[model samples]
Target: MKISDIASISDAQKFILDLYPNDNRDFSYVFGYATRHLGYLCKSLCKNSPSVEEFIRSISWLLALANKLEVDVEVSLIKRHPDICPYCVVAPCKCRWTGKKPAIGIKAYKIPEELFYRAEQIKREKKADFQSHCERLAIIYPGNAYKWDAIGPWQLTSKMQEELAEVHEAATRYLSGRKSIDAVAEEFADLFAWLLSAWGLSFPEGNVDDSFIEYYLAGCPVCGNNENCECELFADLSTQLVDSDKIKELEKLFLALSSEVGFDGDEVSEVLQSLEAASKSQSEPVARAAVDQAKAKTEELEKLVERGAKNAKNATTIAQAIYKAIENFPFVG
Candidate 1:
């Protein structure tokens, strides 16, 4: 399950379906996981590498939840956005800057005659990949990076949280028959824009498509499996269920990526060895220490990228995500 396999929204949805089939998971479960990763993503907003990795995870879970609900993400995006603001019906929306006083005689939610042709044209276009999807949002609402810079990452993350709440509100409305599913999809599309903005602001070095592919190259970051993760479902975090085989698989991935990041493969192997050994330890303190070591190592490697190490950006993104997953592992005291 490489990133290319899930480049477009439709592709990503299918990739998620392949990894975690709808029949095996319920909507609530999938939504819970999505929100859970979204929470982690928020925490990493100020950190570029970790945030990019978490963004990929968060979006993947969101796609999974959409699949469980039988939502057509690509179609929803097209209908709600249409290469322009759904409300403003114009590219590079001026609603905020213009104080919502759009052109006269044009009511809210109505596409004007001048823009209708372009909107219809965009709808006929093929589904775009993650990078193009984010880029489209940038086009629709330009200057997001500048806005994000002015407000700071804290405010950026806060905006993301707000959008997620709107998604919840929209979903609730649909479930209660107060709104249509299309409305819910619109909110999700907004959330996706905010999320992509967060990623673009922090990590502007490469396209999100490449970053996502790098982190998810091995499929499930935890279990290292392509389809149907072998890791215990995160249904309960209090339980201790460390799988040594999965740990070894993660270690192998780290080793394979060491040279790509200009890091010593032996050092990378040693860090995971400690993590593997600690996962088997009876003392909670030992596992906690190993988690810290892995985190410190991840940070050090990221610093190497900061120091201009070749190709470290792609490799360290995966390293950050892997360590974050380890830190959040269901380690019991």
Candidate 2:
């Protein structure tokens, strides 16, 4: 299914364009180097992380930055699904670690972090929420579905960090290796695209067009593949099993929730709270009310553009929403 590995995508292009970092391509390796450096940085930054909750929260903060950029990090795991490399289709993927073929399912290693592996571990138990068709992906590329556990804060080694720095420098040179001096910086930005992906961050958002997936998920960030900007995206995370009713409630206040892009990190902790509200308000009233609210919002947007309302175009849609609401209020001066 891996859409990214097979063909280019729209969202991916929008992502890369936004990440314009330099003028050249040779220096793009800095992104790859950042990948290796992250583990060490994460280890140090999360040293005081008490429980998995603390760890997930820290990671969510990182996720906030990712969401703003539209990186589609799920594609990162799919791109690196070791099944193709080791041809292993099972948990632990012993073939990757041991370089040996397995009999039935591939054997694997002991993942380090308790938090990151939470999803993967659940997957290992056949409990990951998935579709009947997704099971096919499991059959053909059957193994751990996600990369969270394999890449924990404490999972990387010291030698990896040293090598990452070297890779960063190499990528830098590649960006401007043959191009004009000004082009080097462009290359650096490209490489940074890879670095962010490796960090499980979304690829840059500006790349969202015909050429995005290709640029963001490019197989080789350094050598410059002949298949440049041709990566594919198999699934859309927005459509996946994250409990929509919950998301709708969040989506209802979505304007409000988007206090930060998608939703505020602070509000993420209140996800369960929102979910409970969703369950209680399953009647048509909540949904009908939401539809009415959304319609009102759309009409407001049209008014702003139509009238060229002062301080409107300069404001975000949500800001405009608030502004319009205030205007409609009948409070006494």
Candidate 3:
């Protein structure tokens, strides 16, 4: 498959779902895995590791969350950033020159039939890399923060963690019957935006070490099938598998931390159950609820920055637990 066809947000989601056909993992697990890979990306950057595998993995999880939540990633992106900077309404982005805030609720100009086409147009028009795209997006949709200032990689990673926590909380609320899935989807979108920002920061030259499409072009990386994969050993056997005992230990640690932090365990498990159900059946209502829940969570987090910080820390712990559980399982397919 061509990169253009496979790399579109929709196609990527389908490809990932196909590789893990039996996946009934919850939204928390998905978000947790994504966050974990992002944390790895941050580690690689900090340690000056040349590998980009973690970046690709992180992006994959974000795309998977987008699929699970039924969010149109392409639409979300293009709407905020078209051919020109949505803020300055200029190709070269005159936001700094104009010293004015981005116009509110502006629509995208020249939306293409395919998201890939739009991406290419953006590349040509701006001569920008992945990181630049993120910067432009921050300018266009500053959210409620009022100002669009340059943030360093560390800050970007921190923001990414914050968004991840918001998504987690939204999922928890959805399980508790206090919110809808749409709210969850919205927070997932925010998390995705931050992941993209991290991606750009990690690879400023626009050179991704691995092509997501190419990696999966032949189907499941392990089973080598587009459907009905039957690989008993899903993990990349080449890497050391995380010990099952270690995972259990980490799980206990996570539970302890969650309790200490006053997280609702019942609600978290309920959200996970709902997410698993949604994934298995692809139920429209269930997926839609998750999206609305994501949106609600985002709004709620914005209002509770201090509490959000605590939640973010908890989320990191949860993600660490998840990584311990699956770090050995390879689905690079």
Q: Model-by-model lDDT, in order?
A: 0.69, 0.34, 0.54
True-vs-predicted CA distance for residue 305, candidate 1, Å: 29
Candidate achieving higher lDDT, 1 or 2: 1
lDDT (10s digit) by residue, model 3, range 30-73? 77767766776665555555245666677777777766666655
The alpha-carbon root-mean-square deviation between model 1 and the true structure, to one decimal in Å, is: 9.6
- Tell me the lDDT of model 1 at 288: 68
| Candidate 2 structure quality by residue, lDDT tens digits, 1-333 | 122432222223323333322224222232432352355344533342222222222222222223333343333233233223223434444565545554344234432122235435433544211121123233333232243245433332233344345434543454447434223332322332223222232212222222323333443233433433332322112211233454354344434523323333443434434444534665444433433454444444445445654444433565455445333321201
| Highest lDDT against the true fold, candidate | 1
lDDT of 3: 0.54
RMSD of each: 9.6, 19.1, 17.7
Candidate 3 residues lying further than 4 Å off, grouped into runs, are 1-4, 80-152, 207-210, 228-333
Model 1 C-alpha lDDT per residue in residues 161-266, reported as the tens digit of each score:
8877787787777777998887788777777778876766666676877776677677777777776766666643222346555455556656645666767866
Query: Per-prediction TM-score, please?
Result: 0.66, 0.25, 0.50
Q: Choose the strongest candidate by TM-score.
A: 1
Write down the TM-score for model 3.
0.50
Rank order by lDDT, top first?
A: 1, 3, 2
Off by over 4 Å in 1: 1-4, 47-49, 112-117, 125-127, 235-333
